[model samples]
Target chain A: MSTLSEPPKQSFHMGMLLNDTRYRGYTFQFIALLALVALFGWMVSNAVANLAALGQDINFGFLSDQAGYDINQQIIPYESTDTHMRAAFVGVLNTLLVAVLGCILATIVGVVVGVLRLSNNWLIARLMSVYVEIFRNVPVLIWILIVFNVMANALPSPSTFRGDDATASMLLGAFAFTNSGVYLPLPLWLEGSIVVVGVFVVSLIAIWALRRYARHLLYSEGRVIPTLPIGLALFVVPTLLAFFIMGRPIALEYPEMGRFNFQNGIQVRGSFIALWLALSLYTGAFIAENVRGAIQAVSKGQTEAAASLGLRPGRIMSLVVLPQALRVMIPPNISQYLNLTKNSSLAAAVGYMDITGTLGGVTLNQTGRSFEAILLLMAFYLAISLAISGIMNLYNNSVKLKER
Target chain B: MKNSLLLGAIAVTGMVAGAATADTLQEVKDRGVLNCGISTGLVGFASQNANGDWQGFDVAICQAVAAAIFGDANAVEYNPVTNQVRFEILNSGEIDMLSRNTTWTFSRDVDLKLDFLGVNYYDGQGFLIPTELGVSSAKELDGAKVCIQKGTTTELNVADFFRVNNIEYEPVPISTASEAQQAYLAGTCQVYTTDASGLAATRASFEDPSAHVILPEIISKEPLGPLVRHGDDDWGDVVRWSLNALIAAEELGITSANVDDLAAAPTDNPEINRLLGTEGTLGEMLGLPADWGVNVIKANGNYGEIFEKFIGENTPIGLARGLNAQWTDGGLLYAPPFR
Candidate 1:
């Protein structure tokens, strides 16, 4: 028979909040929180006091003021008389455009170079290693400056295409190459073009569905299908059929030589080209290293087992190696995307009218609203980085390894 | 305890930030150096020499101000500011004065709370183009791409110029004059726009200076001057009269060579005697020594000497004194009376 003995019950008292072990930890935490809140309150008040003393109050009315400036490349409508808010929005679009373009180009280059760097061919592997070392070791700013200089200096001027005895001529009689920029024919969308675009979209989805089915058949029924050839057929046939069926609703407006520049065409400015390519090449090098590490992280036995099962080398890689490597590779790759978006602030150096160049630049200087403009810029970059992280995490979830 | 310490630091930092808003003159005196802001490099305006000493047209103004305050021309700390951060740097008290080619405008003076001392260079915007481009008039420059320095009035003037002419032109905003020069030479931009004097300075540095021509268009009046933040009128008067002394010395035929002779004692010319601190108590009004004008003139000679030494026609800049001459010579450079 066990005799139960009750320990001495301590009475609840006000002193127990600090002396008792259970409450002491919480008491310290509460004190810390109180101190933190007080600190934050003090900082805000201090800033308000300092600004007031300078005869300046925090105001964002300047956003409605005229920008009084012009942008080199604008994706939306803008004028010197436009409000700063609209100008900032145009800057936002340009920044997004470069970031999106840079991400796509970096992924393509990083994946190709990463796979090639692991090749048994010594020359190819060594060359990729050299490229990664050179591009990543130096700062991104230097690469941007170098690429901008090369684009401007190496390209011929428009005057070279002028006279009968011209030293240079337009390529393909439609594309004009000049240091000012490359002049490409503008695409004109007429009536019924929307139907053609819809058809093209439908065909792309169909191709994706067919590929999924092909994979299903291979796994479940031991069947093989030539998905590439059939997917090409599915992609091309309907798009062409819809285009002709829509009565040729698209046309090209070729650039015509004006007195000073090529008028009536879209100019892909050198500044954009320089910033996009430089950011891609620099960030692609780090992504290459990540891919290389991720590939090696998957044990060698997996590859050997696939080889013994009579799988072809290319099929073994596509089916077994890269899919597993992607999970390990994605987290670090997400950070690279963040780095690229932030580094694009350096777009001002190359004269690319990205958000930093316009809003954080001329608008800040002209309106003398450096504080408000910078706060908005910081908010934008922070929002973009979080959004990128969230999108990448969702992608990571899809390839996550399953465990019981 | 750690968080409390951090909060204490935050409090101290706030007080310090607010404390720097005024009494800039005392701060400079305690530091024993005059902080002067200038452009990164504009060869004839502000740049470092072979001896690693800062020397140029704008540099001269800095030296004069420093000499007026410290009685030593070399008691200066040069802060090179870009087009984007000049005003912020000045307002933050990192630089006591900005001697860069900053224009005096209504907004910059009253709205931005800056006190412009006086105009040192009277400039106007103009266009520089390749000679063989066959473009004579700026109105003919329709559809041309322009490379211009942002944060200056040049871009606004060019935009207004083309808008008034009913022509469409693109502006490639560049950071510095050197990069703009590279873009212009590479033909990436069909035109480069800035002050006419700056265009001349840039052309003189070109490989083939004759291959380019400056378009005759004075788009906007840019009265470039030195400036200080408001609430320091004592320091402002010190800087203002230093500039006046330079201009008056030029009008009174007192060069750097004769400054010592003129300041030895009272001269026959009463204005010269007063300006050189050899008569009356003019320097006392500005809280400087009786020999304040001597220090200023000895720092960089008179305004005409400085202009001729750096950017006059005799120099490679080849800028003729069209509107920068003294009023006696039918120009607009007239200083206020000293007495």
Candidate 2:
């Protein structure tokens, strides 16, 4: 048995700050705080003195100055006469575009490969295992370089696409992949295309409502309503009807064969293609392992219980195993997405003018503002990473189980 | 406690500030090596040879400076920096002088606070294209994809050229010259544009050098040279005169072969006497020994000799000394008189 009582009372003294046990933790913490402040102060002071000696000052006035450089690809209107800020904005958009595209592609490839790796088929499982080993074991940078080289050497020249006796022909007579880039047909929005798109959105919401109604019927009246076929009808019937009523308001603009390239079409540059494919394949390998681990982490007893309850194998996976496996999979998957986004900075190696290629690179070299440019680059990447993690965390919270 | 911490911090920072403001010349002397900035590798301009020794046009300049200071041509420590980090390395005092192939521009001089001593190589932007392209003039390069070295004036120059000509072209900005060369050869781009000297160097390294032709268009002036920090006039003067000594040696017919003989006895040319440090105390004024000019010429023969040895028509690079020849030979290279 233990009892709490004041056995002795001692008077406090000046030496107690160092000797007394009760005040010891606070004293050490106070000293540590002071040391941290001093270190920071010393570093800042040294930086200030060094800058002064170099006749340099931290200036942001150059952001508004004319960039006087042309960018090959831009999503918005940009000219050489635009300001540095405008050029940087274009770079930021390009970076985001590739990162988003890479993440989506990586996720799809990862989930497919992850699930297939557990297949009972020996041939298929071995093939997937080989792919994962080769991609995951090699450095991502080397993979990027290798992919870029292969694309550069393997693709036919644009000139080969020209003339009646052309050496290379476009696949499906629409997509042209050349040494420079890939060209594809773009969608031409006719007058009533907006109405057609609106109808499609309405149909999607109607399908969701139909599924909810089916679930309510099953719960309240013990009457099982077949939702899949009705939901499919809701998904297609309105959209098809709207398309005809609106005079089929979407048209395709095919890429026309030109002397050097396929003009009048959308061009996806080879650098972007290489960077996207390399990042997806490399990151997908790691993500595949995460997915496999998560799936296995779901206990086998869950599947057995579902089987005993007369659930089919597919339904058991969808309704019982998957939901639980996803919770385990998503947290690690968020980190993979973050990794892919950060690795997109390597787009510079292939000349894809991402944020690092333009602002942190050429702009810094041109303006001699390394300190400011690097600081801004760090800040932008930090913000992007934190934003990705924050959004993923929120989604994770919604899917997480309630605990006692 | 906070007051004592503040006092200690101030003391430490004061020592750092003192070290940063130390005279670069004295520091170099104390360190016993002149830190020189150069490119990672650019054939005939700044690159290491097969013998694992640095030998190039820009390397000669650094050697000349080192010889002028210590009477030893090998007294330099070369720091090979990438284009993205060269200026920062120079600005941070990590290198004593930047002898890299850096172009002198208005902004680099006035805004970046760098003092360019003199232009050692007069290069202008030009284009290189494969023979199959049949593009003789830059005007024919309309709608062509061009490979350009990034972080340099070539990108902006090419952009301005295309825009002003009212022609459309795509720029594939590459990080290094080797990458640009690879991409151009791999058919990723139709044209490669850089300084004319750079084009020559790159073409010489190509597997089929004869299959490529440089377009006859010098679009922009790129006066490449060595530079130092703006406020350091004493060091700047030493570097300027060392380069001037080479130019002067070429003009006076005093090559490395004849430098010692020319300095042994007073000649009819008093300017030669003053330059050879026999008739005046010019080296003393620069805080160097009496034979500084002799050492500089001995390090690298002379401007013409250096040019011929590295990138002249006889060399693999085969760059013609067109505008780089001396003023007396109807070229732009004119040095200030030594008197």
Candidate 3:
């Protein structure tokens, strides 16, 4: 045993040497890591040197200074006397407003066009194909410009539509398009409308509970109840009763012609309308292609199996195809939403007071703080994109198939 | 590879040697060309015609600078620049001088480190609205949406003016003058704001020029002038005194027609002699030939002649030489002593 151990000492030394050799293989990776750190450090130092040379120290103190600029459309209260940070918040809110509204409208348009493009009717399919092809191929900026030009040239001047004349009334009632913007009636709430709204919320909960009960009855008792009708009744009955009890606290406020322009009701500027419409149309075209690809990605075998199980065509699509298609659809759809949010920045070109227009344009010019303005603008966009991705990832996870 | 390396070394040495000996003024003289930056089609300032030749008040300045440098009026290259990119281009040395209607402000001079030669045009920010709005004065534009071109001093002036007046305004900011004009015409904004001279230029482009009214309020001081990069003091002096020579020529009754005659025979006025390079070493001070001012006057008419030709009362812009007149006429345009 002593002789055998004495012979193995050299082998033990060889094993340690082999281990050291393996460790040396990672030296290249270590060097790469050090190189990356050095590159970043060099860049940071260069930025500091450049900033110092310009006598422009990077600080956020300017954000609290008076913005001294006015925003055309702000969701929150803003004034020229407000701080730049508050102005940035207003710009953020305006960006979110356009992004949210654009997403919802784009989704609706996308779904409709996507399904119509696969329709049995040839003419409708061809028309939707044209829409998708045209919008998807052209740059979004051109679409924005074209739409703005059309709105500017085609809409009647405000001076021509400021009276109760027959032509003016007819045109205003039909389209309500004016140079000031497109005016439409909004529902105005009176006193005690909160009670009615509370009733409506309670009814919605009841309707959801009724739907659950109906599903349970269908499974347990094998009795088919018209859940849609019962749900509708549960929703409308209490809301109507509360409306009468609260004395009908809602009224439609139609736009009325006033001196120089329209008064009352909602007035959306032509720039916003043109920009919103162009962004929705352009993004919806891309989303429609994604929807189509996702739908086609679902195996035909699933639909056939559902049909073999005696399900109708519509049920096969709803129960079998859509569940699987949605899994493939959500990731790409999130990216489209992000695209729509970023493209809304192009509204600046058309004079729409989105974040890029107000903060990046006028605020930067007024303050001469390009660094702060552009940094805030990029951060806002990044945060919005991350939020959308987070929500969509959760939705994708819920609809994803569990694989062995 | 060794032979190629030796050849590359020789080429780089030759290039450096050439660069070391190159004189900027002599290079310009030899090349017989001067690169100048001007506005992108402002009507009475600098604009291109259908024939693609630049003409107007600002263009004449470029021509005069070229003529001062190279004894020929046609030795100029004009590059159009917008407000957003003009300063960066000048700083990067892409153009020799910026003759666009740029407002000479404190920040541009000190912070940006540019040398504003002198105020060629005294202007101010003014508001313009459709006459149908019945707004005769800027004070009445309360709760109005003002269309302003972004990335310029005019935008800040608009905000400050509105705030000081206790008026609420929706600023519909745009990137270009054309966009502001379209927005104002389409009623997206109730009023359009810019320099008073710019308002006149924009209004003249309309089908009916009388349909818009320029508000009486001149809210901000805009001393529009030419500028060059900061460190080139010799170049700065050259541009400054060249402009002053034009003003001094007009004051001395030295028209372009009589400049050759006056140069051949010395004038009675010492200021004219110094400006025309007949007296003093002003030309030698700037490292130019003695007839530099004469060449400038020959290239373009004097300041008054150029202003009268482009934006005078008879022109479509119809701007009066109210504050742009000489000191003898009680205006602010007084040059420093030529000596």
Best-fitting candidate, measured by DockQ? 1
* Interface DockQ of each model: 0.66, 0.52, 0.44
lDDT of 3 by residue, B269-311 (tens): 8888888888888898898888999998887789898898888
Error of 3 at A251 (Å): 3.8
What's the C-alpha lDDT at position A88 in model 1? 94
True contacts kept of each: 0.71, 0.59, 0.56
Tell how far residue A305 is off in model 2, in angstroms.
1.1
Q: What's model 3's TM-score?
A: 0.90
lDDT for each residue of candidate 2 in A154-182, tens digit (9 for 90 to 100): 99977677777889998898898888899
The per-residue C-alpha lDDT of model 2 at residue A242 equals: 91
iRMSD (1 decimal) for each model: 1.6, 1.9, 4.9
In model 2, the Cα lDDT at residue A100 comes to: 93
Query: In candidate 3, how many Å is residue A381 off?
Result: 2.7
Which CAPRI category fits model 1?
medium
Worst 10 residues of 3 chain B by lDDT: B15-24
* lDDT measured at residue A236 in model 1 versus the true structure, 0 to 100: 94
Q: B1-339, model 1: which lDDT tens digit per residue? A: 787888788788866775655576677778989999998988789878899888889999999989987899999999999887898888888899999999999989987778999999999999999999888899988888898998888888887888778888999889899889988888878899998888998999998999999997788999999999887888898889999999989999989999999889888999999998888998788777889899999998999999999888888888888799999999999999878
TM-score ranking, high to low: 1, 2, 3
Model 2 local distance difference test score: 0.88
Clash-forming residue pairs, model 1: none
Candidate 2 chain A weakest ten by summed lDDT: A1-10
